[model samples]
Target: MSRHRRQRGGPTFARAATLLQITKLVEFPAVFLSSIVQANVLPSRQYGQLVVDLSIAFIAATVMSLGVEESLQRALAANPRDRAIWTEALASRAFVGLALTLLAGILLVCDQTSLAIVGCIVVANSIYDLVVAQTASLLRPAVPSIFNIAAVIAASSATLLVRPSSSISCLTITLIFSSLRTAGCVLLSCRLLKPVRLSFRDAVRMPNLADRGWRPLVDLTVYRLTNNILNRQGDLIIAGIVAVDKTSVGTYALAFSLTTAANTVFLTGIGSMTLTRFSATYAESGKFELGKSWQRMTYLTAFLSSWPLAILIAIGPGLSVILFHGKYPGLALYLVLIGVVAWLGRISGGGANIAVLFTLRNEKLVRKVFLMAAAMNVATDFVLMPLIGMYGAIVGTMIGTFFSSRFLNVQIRRRTRSSVEWSPLLLLSCLTAIVTAPVALLHRSFTLSICAVVVSLCLWATFSWRSSICPPEISSRVHDVFGKKSSVGTD
Candidate 1:
């Protein structure tokens, strides 16, 4: 009945879940700092520039990373000793990071904002990857989130004082500094590996050539590439099509920043546990229960996300008006959508993605999937944005994600002889849709808030009744999450 214990899985789940919760706690700081940034520091022009910079940087970092971060995750089984990964991962990252930094500097000098942004993102992200890989090798999830929070707090404090008008430069500088901080923290925390000093011997021990997971690496690479294009391409589009207004850009960036904060919930809680569960589940029962567990997890996410999302969509306008000083006038509407996006991320199947990312040989299809989706996403954005604005980019994103999931699901079926339960998904989707309607349309925050409470109570009661009748096999797991607070499935 432990929260970390699934029907089957290793002891690592406890560490993983704890790490996730710790990471989730960091979201509080991230969100809080972002609000401050939007309210006081980031103007439209500065914010817009940050987006352009991030979009470019993210793409570069992703390319240079070449799925190495994921490779670390996928290769956990083969390299359980966690020896050479740090050295090799760091060296590889260093090479990519330097190249990208130089490239960004050149682009900046040449006045190519987008290209410079991309290069900056790449270098910054590479530092982040190296830190993350080392942390994971230490097999300590909490370390990563802890590093993340510390780094953010430090960066925000430094940047807030300077409060530079140029967000792009400030952001890039903070990122580099933060990455260094994270690396130091992660290295220090790795008591298990007893990390030898970074030297010739460390370099020799950290092998760059891991042969086991190239196939899965390809899959992961492609998936991330396409997903990023879908999610991060907006800055480019905004810069190109819009009037290059910084305030407009800043408002949107602030909204997206908030969204990123919101999405951390899924990353820490769902993604962390789901990945751990997959490791355990595959080891325990092949793929049979994976599908069922996936369905159940998806349902739980649907319910959990719905209430907060409803509140956001309902009260968002009022909150924005009061809190933001029209810095981001209608940001609440976008925030609601962002919450939906965050919640939808839960369905991306942590296990399947991990399995595919680790494959050294069978990853060709995954690469193809990424390339095709990226192409299609760009095409959709190109076609849609002129007509529909930012939502057009979202459309492109939806198309790409739908394809990715369908592709992953196909692989899932072939591997495990299991299928997604479309019926329940559809049912919940419909219920969420109906429940979300009043919040979207009803402007009165108090009324909507009251309605939301009533609806949540009703839904919980119904879910509780269903669980009693069916008798959840994983009822014990509920005790761990709720502890003495309360659990839905348990009597």
Candidate 2:
């Protein structure tokens, strides 16, 4: 019976992991579509204002979250039946949500109507995000993802139908759709996942963090918040300081959204698979196998992400015009510059550290690295944005990512005493250079650019295969396809 259980465990885990990956990847299209529709349909100023409001709401949600979601996931993983902890987390979240709501109400008196509406949705989404996080930790992520997909479709359809003509109308529609999505997430959490429902009694009881230690919770929360500020909050930063003109903000937002599509669909979704594999590998062999696993995962992610990113940097301008209806001039150039910065950010973004540290349960180290990185980000943004306009934010993001990646390396070495190899990134950079240089040297001919990309990808694949960086399955298939040719040619 035990043997059967072990056999079943492998397949079951794989299935669940696959589902989660699919969920994230599938969610991307709906999200990207919604952004596209919103960008095209709304007037430029309205869309820019909407981005600013949403950004503020997200910041509020991050604060009000109070790190409970991360703490809850860890606590539940340690003791799944610990109802007290679950209740405590739920109660804390409820209180924070209420406080935020009250603050939002006060904003109405202050005439910050847009922010107030956004605050309501933020509160709802924060709870919903917590539930989804819980479900993912419970290894049944598909349930919430299903509800998320439904909500997105419904929201997008409604937004499109309404075609909000003004900023206020758009904000109202956004609030309504966001609330509906939250409701769907909550219902699915209760019905499908059978979450521990927290009563008013449970909602008020605070946990004693002194006894259990709040280090992990604080580390993860600060890391996530700071990371978001650096990477994902560019539109907000532009709205606040970098670009005062709504059209400029709107243009940057549109281009950034396009880059996010690449991240969501390809880079991030695929990256999660490595985290799962690393966790299992560490559990089985501890630090002995972790170094190699980390290296392989990093190389694999670099290989997978390099081409699409290079493609984006190469063809982003033309693609932007075609996709977004050419509302903003110079958008293509903005897309290219942002795409390069984003790709650099993605490659050097320290997924290996995240996977390894989380596996080692060294949350404190992770937190410290991110905190420093966040500081670097803030300082860089302030200096650069004042000097270089919107490009300053992009440059700051790139530099901030470099700092974070460097600190992550330092932590990994202190713990494992092993150095991570840079050959993979060097190789990827070489490939990108090969692909993009010709396009820059030659005049803007779409056909030549496409040929350069295809040829560069072929070269990259061949080089990776020769270097043994290609996965075993792909290598095997390649050998089978080419083996007969080599033998026949020799004859």
Candidate 3:
């Protein structure tokens, strides 16, 4: 029998992408509200502490999860009914959680209460993520996605209503909501699938390195660790550790959170779907079809992301003042810097890192690329942060992103012997940058900034529409949405 099932012809790329985008659209508001509430209500020092605490929690969670989540997903995808792998994975995660809980207790005894709270978050988030991985593997992601949305809404509502005085209180409320969501997910999963039983004996033992999944598990774990450190919370963590004042950390965290939110909303949706799509395409067809799909999706990602990037550049300073209720001196510069780097990184060589892992199945290569990037990022941050503060962290990240993207593109091309078609994406990016340039001058006047943003978007849209810069698949979908027949033809 084949190790993997034959293609059952899942959702079309366009349909899958559209559904993912819709899902993010529904989720983004709650997430945005949560961020806004936290930023606006908390004092800068408290907010900085909160950011640091959460970053530490996330990093710890990533470490404890042991990258077995991806291994479990791959195993379950091949055989969804495999109870043995499922149980083993859960036991492994449980074992790590238990160990971490003990560490938390130790910290509590040492009077590091904030870190103790983070330790609790680490356990909760790790297990929750494992459950989510299982859901995705079983092709029932909506189960956990719904629960996640509800959890965010509940937590954010409580925060806004209660207006907690301390970061600890806010984090406690968040943990409560998160734990509830985890319980809900477990119950719902048990109902939908088989009940997951964790064996105490299994939980106490270390994983067998002799197992077939060991190599991939290690690779993925390192990849995720490096990626998280470099991209997700590394800046905040470094700033929290190295900055002279909590206010600077808070400012950087706020800017980081906003840009990350925008990224999650616009770019992440498509990237999330690419792994499955690329895997299936390579399985059923060949590298040729996979390359085509990659190009198409890359173009679409660039097109969708450009709008948010432009908007951020145009009105970022004004939006910062309005949302935070104060002038953040470098907030506008942070937005522009982070936004541009993020956009460029995603489109660089058509997001080759993701394609390499999911399509080429080269975990080692992915791990190496990210590790190199992380090292570069850390080195730069350490060198510059003491001299220039938060700006150093951002600049470090920018340099690392550029290097990693370029390195991945070159390595993937050499391995796959395929090239990304970048003409349309390049044109779109150039046009977006050109039109949004004037907004930098107008940023001081909120009214003028807004007006400039509107004008810039309109001009870009008109030009892109007329120039046919969008991928045919996306353009056709857009036309269909507007009840217009597509004039663009696919190859």
Candidate 4:
């Protein structure tokens, strides 16, 4: 049954995956440029505060969203023409947004942070998330890309144009940029699905969703919030506990931003597609027979994620020195370590687990795993950050990810009990070590190490083609692209 299903729908799935990858590629340059601007233009102290405020806004927005972005996507993907789902989801989302606004206002009064900027950023970013999901749910993967690309380009240009004197001013520009992107995405989403006449008043109205409908939102939100705390919000904890100055705080934040940019892109692209793909598969197959798909996607994610981190490790030092004018010394090493952590995140079964488990409606397991990891991360950060500083925080994040991945692997095994390949993951892990070992051991000449890593990856790819561990879809695509007639049977 699974074989027949794969034979019939594999090409469509492949195309969806490709379009999703293109979406990430489209967003990457703008996001990277924006990060560069944020890192370079501001004073360290101000940057640190900016990082804190931004993180707060992000977390608050996620909390406010109540996981509606993903929940809406999953629901809408199941019934794309369901206007009621759209109205109800948006209504609940707006209610949460209003509550968040009041909370942001209180925080603004107490902390003297720019509430207006944070508020705008939160609303805009959250709206964008929903609209992207909306578009993707309708199988218009490329439409979100158009809106996102335009917004990113506009934001990047505005960042250059405004030349804000203060961090607050810079943040205001950031908010405006996000708002522009949100506006574009919303407009596009609405235009593409015009039968569902959505309105502003509908956003504030009470959603008449059932308890089962709302449960997934809460579960997803918990996992997402905890995950964000582990990855993005930890910098604030580091700042409060260990940082003596704003520069140090900003340095840690910058290191995170630089190292995890690739991680964000890959996850955003892959994550956006997985739920829809998995749900659609279940709808067709009438069973959760997606172990092979999960394995293939996981391996593909590792392949897509590893090399960028390797290159970043290689070029980060020189780039940091040149870009920041030596403001962040030892940043290259930080980038290398953080990059490895990011690489581990991909191969260690984190992304696949989240997508698969969620699609399976195993939200209980997902929440438990993330909660456990989040707790460990927070504890590790508290214990280590003050003792060892920024490295400690990075270590804390790695440790949490490791725990999460390990738990996820165990859960996948227990649930699916299918023969999913792990050798590719093992090989990729070795490749990661090989790619980063030189920089870790000798601590010099990142360019040479980068060349070595690239050569090794090319050789790995050359050899991987002959191995059964490689995903058949990827191997076939490689052959087709290079004009080779090949039949790599799907395992």
Candidate 5:
């Protein structure tokens, strides 16, 4: 029976992951192109301010969320037809949005239009996040992914048409598109599930609506808040506080943006799918199946992430020069440092660990790990930023990522009592480092960089195919694509 269940679950999970990846592939280029346009059109200082505002808005949205989105996702995964949970979560988000709108109005009345704009953005982002979470929990991420892609393309086209010259103008355009995105998501979700009438009363009654108990919800909220702050906006916030000028902040922001783009394109989809699938697996089959799922996702994420890191290392310098007109100094080094941090986190199985822990309902441990890492990240930034400037932020993030990821892996191993097969991850990491090192040295040579990327990817593919580093299903699929037979066995 267990084997039968595994066989049934594997294909469903793979199809979902594949759909999400296709969505990201469509969305990433639009987002990357938009960043390039903004960087070229806006002055460095203005772009820096723009980055600061967006960061603040996102951080604020996470705070306002109160972790309800994630809590709802977990709940829905276990009980997908739970209408009460869905209604309460929607009401909570609506209430938060209303409060932010009121705050925006007050800010505008006080003549703080810049802050007002940010307040509005916070509302839009928060609502969008909740709606997307709702769809993802229902195991239908493609719906929101499609709308999100549309939003990005529309916003980018509008930006190109208007060609905003200042931070405020750019932000205003962003707010407009962001609101539209939120509306589209909400509309789509309504079609999928019954639309609940939201009121301030439901918001006031949210505490009492914790049908599963409040402690878990609160713990999840806290964990998510800290994790979001550390991962999303920590460096920029610290850089803004410690840097001498906005240009430095903007430079770091641009570098981080490129790394983030890579992450969004390659990892975000799989990570989301992993959480939902892991939650379902845990509910149905317990930790044994959960451990198997984690190993598969870890290997898959590492393999997919390696391609972007290789490309970035090989051609990032020339790409930066062409895209940003060589305006941002030290861009290449920042890319490599931040990119390594992301790659390290993946190979360390950080994302899979978090998903597994969440599925196991170990929120308190996750919260503690994230809080400690957040503190370390902030402390490192404060101590090093004044002395070393932007590099301090990069180093701080690297330290925080390393510690949190390693700690989480240890906890996961203890709880599951399942040993991780690290050979594949180690092999991939070593090969990636070796092949990309020469390209990094010759990053200035565009021809060599291009050739190196092709060579590196071919090597990765050949080695992975021969050694069966990829998950068995993936390997077999590749075999089918090439009209060959796979000798790989199922887990």
Candidate 6:
């Protein structure tokens, strides 16, 4: 009887993990379509600042999150022996939320407007990340949909009240809704988890930050930090490095906003599931060999995420010209580049699970790699921004991401039995480039020969590669997730 119960519940656990991954793919359109609606409806200045704000806010949250939420989430899945660890992480994260607010307030008091604004973003970010971390780890993936639906509703409501021709109020509406979305998720968490009442003392007592758990915490922070500078810092730097002209910056923001939002769906959605699954696997087996299953999933995601970006890079400018009536053609290029870059970025993210899995054993070594990556990112940004303009920001991203992928990232991943499926990315990129060239030349045509070819190939590649793509566990897990199930993902 006990064995039967375990068998039934086992699928549930597996399905929950898969839901976390699918949520990203399933939710992609929601984010992209919503951004388009908001882009068409919001004032340019507000929209630019909003992009910059969200960008900076994420970075701030990284600093402020202090790895507490991640700690809790992993403990929830992989380490139930210390139940108090979950409570402590939650408490520490909450306390940090307060601290982030205070930190933001100080910058505001000093009249550091950018920093102050960054502070607000951080506070919002901290709340959102914690809410997401908790829900993704503790509840079923559908609960996350409740939060997404709430965000969609809030964003749509804001759009209805705002218009492209309206004033900056549109931007404010968008930001408000984003912040409120975090609050709504928290409400759902309360209802679902009925999380035990925890106090500051209990949270603080748990050895969360610098203890054995600190390894994952440190690796995540530095890795997140490096990515932030490469990706997030681009917007703010645009305002300074090349965005000295208000209208120009605003135009770029319009395009960049769409790409970032869409990419976030994939990054945020799948990233959590990957982290949680790998972390749990690590806890159970202490084997990096298990991550090989994820390597298979990586191939599928790389193929799936790429050509759309290639197509966008091909068609986005024309679409922009028609959509916004040429509100900003330059932005179209930014969007395409960002999409391609994000797809490239995600191709590597599946590998990060190794870092988390190995973190406990290689904590100090992992920290050094991330710190090194961060330093390179900052140095490159400082040196390159003056040279290539906003595009240079992406150069930093490419460089940093490349460095991480080739150097530190690979080393850590080597600890696991899994090897990076580097061929697909190169193959996809080359094929995409070949296909896109003709489309670019045919700028005047409504239909792109290059885009058509790319899309057809993308579909083929995605489907053709599915069986060849996932590792045994990942394939089994994915099937488990999408198939009929009664119990596991019900949470």
The most accurate candidate by lDDT is: 5
lDDT per residue, candidate 6, 1-491, as tens digits?
Answer: 43453343333444544554465454444445444543443234344555565566666667665555555555555554344555565455545555655665565566444445445545554565555545554545466566655665665566566653443334344455455555564455345334566555765553544556555566767756655655655445544544344444555555666776555544454454555555655665666534554564465466546646665667775776666777664776777776766676557753453435444445456556556766676677667666655565666666666665556446556666566656646765676766665676567345764546556575445443353553344445445566833221100
How far off is model 4, as Cα RMSD? 4.4
Q: Encode model 3's per-residue lDDT on 235-349: one tens digit a residue.
A: 6677666753555655665677788778767665465545655665676677777666665665567667777788788878677677666645678787888888788787775
Task: Give candidate 3 misplaced runs (Cα > 4 Å).
Answer: 1-13, 33-59, 72-113, 116-146, 195-213, 349-352, 443-473, 482-491
Model 1 lDDT tens row, 65-182: 5666555444443344445555454544554455556666667667765455345534553565345534542445455556666766765666556654554645554455445544
Better of 1 and 2 by lDDT: 2
* Global lDDT of each candidate: 0.52, 0.60, 0.63, 0.64, 0.68, 0.54
By summed lDDT, the worst window of 10 consecutive residues in model 1 runs over: 2-11
| RMSD to truth, every model | 5.7, 6.1, 4.9, 4.4, 4.1, 6.1
Order of quality (lDDT): 5, 4, 3, 2, 6, 1
Off by over 4 Å in 4: 1-11, 37-59, 80-125, 133-143, 198-214, 242-245, 286-288, 432-453
Q: Of the pair 4 and 6, which is ahead by TM-score? A: 4
Q: Which tens-of-lDDT digit does each residue in 1-491 have in candidate 2?
A: 43453353333433443455566565565456545544443334354565676677667666666555544544543444455565555455545655665676577678666676557656655655555444554435666677667766665666566654344444455455455555554455345324566666555543433465767557767777777777746435544654445555556666677776665554543443445455556655677677766665556566666776666656655565565556676677766777666666545536776767876877777777777777777777777766665666677777878777767767776776566456856775787777776684554556666777777778877887777776443455567787733211100
Residues 178-262 of candidate 4 have per-residue lDDT tens digits of 5566556445544533666656666544342344676766787888888877785655645454553545555666677766666
| Model 3 TM-score relative to the real fold | 0.79
What would you estimate as the lDDT of candidate 4? Answer: 0.64
TM-score of 6: 0.74
Name the TM-score of candidate 4.
0.82
